[model samples]
Target: MKVKSLFVLTAMIGAIAFHQTALAKERETGRSTGPVVYVIAQDKFYDSIVLADLPAKGRFQQLFPGEGPSGLATEYGPGDVGYLGGRWWVDGNENGEMDEEDAYFLCPLLGPGRDDI
Candidate 1:
């Protein structure tokens, strides 16, 4: 029984060491283990533009530069918030209006020099 227990413990330790070595080799080979996310945006002419292409695990800010209300941070509740008018929605089904298939979209709050159309 003692010899059996020792063999099992040795096997477990070897398995763990092998897994760690494999992970280190993968990292040294420059292999990414996370998904890549592409952030798309629309220009004034309604043209689709690739704003950012980064890893999904990377930190990202929702609001773009020069956006949001004055004297306030980029974070804000969506929809009509006092002076800031208009609402944001993701047309998931490619429809013009929000529906069951659509979702609430978090975008930069419009401020001075910004237009919501």
Candidate 2:
């Protein structure tokens, strides 16, 4: 029984690792082409995490300096929390490093949010 349990656990872990590897490759290249691409929005509406089926048009945010392809930090909550699948970058002032001036954005906030649009 113990050996069988260990085998099942190992198989589960291997499957998860393979899924993550495929996802990382997809992120590096382009968005996932699967039929159902789910997206999680960090903003909480009425004390609930929002989840939606990712739209086809305007999916990822364009990365500066042309790093192939990239996306915005969508998992950031109201208080700026971090997560594994969230996007983090440093591309201000056209430099490759995050400095004091490059940390802030020109406008306080960007365009309309997902809920708004």
Candidate 3:
């Protein structure tokens, strides 16, 4: 009975240690374990807008009233801070559409003074 209990305890400890190691490795590799939220902007300027103000799909005119049929924004602007080096998509064609012409841009992980971190 004593040996069985010891073996079980040892197994539990080993499992916990392995989990911790995996988590640390994930962090080091910059792999997100949770949902990542992004803000799709209409332009490179990243104009300030309220989340609640965003209109549903097929309603692009609601967000930019008086504008022609500009379709929708295809640029993925920066979201909340702490994601400096994250990857984002840009509308290479400058058109409000996501097609084969779009490209990806990596957020620079620069330090203060515009130095590389």
Candidate 4:
């Protein structure tokens, strides 16, 4: 009986130690830190991206609306944020390209949104 109890206690301790070590490794690896919120302007394309610490509701970042269209054809303006496949993405309209129709994707699946948390 004594040996059985000792073995059980030892196993529990070992399990806990392993779990802690795994967690520490995960932290050091910086896995699943947070999502990047994309702030898109009404007329922009390229999209303004931000790396958020975490997806917290009511969290905000300032955005500037585009001043008409960019004189340079290659330079894109602003864009909204989006989320899919368990990660924040910026496909704009989800149309596989950035265009005026490509709008922002409100985040809420795992992080922040307008009272959607």
Candidate 5:
């Protein structure tokens, strides 16, 4: 009975040590940090975008809204911060595209409307 208990304790300690080592390696290899942004649009065709690094201590919240539309082609002007990804929140089917009369809230992910993030 004593031997079995000793073996089980040893195994448990080994497992914990292995887990810590793996986590340390992941941090040291620079495999962790990434940018974070949030965007929200309402049903009234108004959309807002926010972009920046993850909030940290001593950091202040910032809001950057785009200027109102200027031409006949563009209707929605940029508003508030920037977004990291464009999420077209529509009230229709899941076609991943915009439709007529469908309320949309698009958060541009990578600065403005770009093809790649």
Candidate 6:
């Protein structure tokens, strides 16, 4: 009887340890929430844009050197945050960088080409 009780307790403790380990892994891999892209203009001709795979956890602000500040950094409630699957923007001068003269626009997250360009 004593051996049986000890075995049961050990098994219970092992199961609990395994459960906690799994929970930790889930937390480590958990995705954050928020806007997928946060864009900010550095100079009159340059823009800074950041892209993320999961939902954004922070605000997206755009500050055009000449145009001033634009966008809100506040979180819009729970699931309201948008996830960016992909993004496309103009690289002014065709240099693969967003410069002052380049036009910056959010491309469709998952679509084929923009007709307005």
Clash tally for model 4: 5
lDDT of each: 0.27, 0.27, 0.28, 0.26, 0.28, 0.25
- Which candidate leads the pack in TM-score? 3
Which lDDT tens digits does candidate 1 get at residues 12-110? 334434442211123333532211111123111110112222222322333222222221122332232331221233233455543444333222322
lDDT of 2 by residue, 59-111 (tens): 22212222211112233433333322212222344565543322221111221
lDDT of 3 by residue, 23-110 (tens): 1123343443221222233222221211121112221211111121221122333443423333333333457764344433222311
RMSD of each: 20.8, 18.1, 19.9, 20.2, 20.6, 22.4
TM-score of each: 0.22, 0.20, 0.24, 0.18, 0.18, 0.20
Off by over 4 Å in 6: 1-86, 111-117
With a 3 Å backbone cut-off (N, CA, C), the pairs that clash in candidate 2 are none
Worst 10 residues of 3 by lDDT: 108-117
Backbone Cα, N, C clashes tallied per candidate: 0, 0, 0, 5, 10, 6
Candidate 6: tens digits of C-alpha lDDT, residues 20-116: 2211122232422211222221111111122322122232222121121211111121123442322322222346444343333332221121121
Per-residue lDDT tens digits of candidate 4, residues 66-113? Answer: 212321111112223421322222222235543333222232322222
Q: Which residue window of length 10 is worst by lDDT in model 5?
A: 64-73
C-alpha lDDT (0 to 100) for residue 35 of candidate 2 = 16
Candidate with better lDDT, 1 vs 4: 1
Q: Give the runs in model 1 whose Cα sits over 4 Å from its true position.
A: 1-86, 106-110, 114-117
| Residue 29, candidate 3: alpha-carbon lDDT | 35
Candidate 5, residue 59: how far the Cα is off, in Å: 49
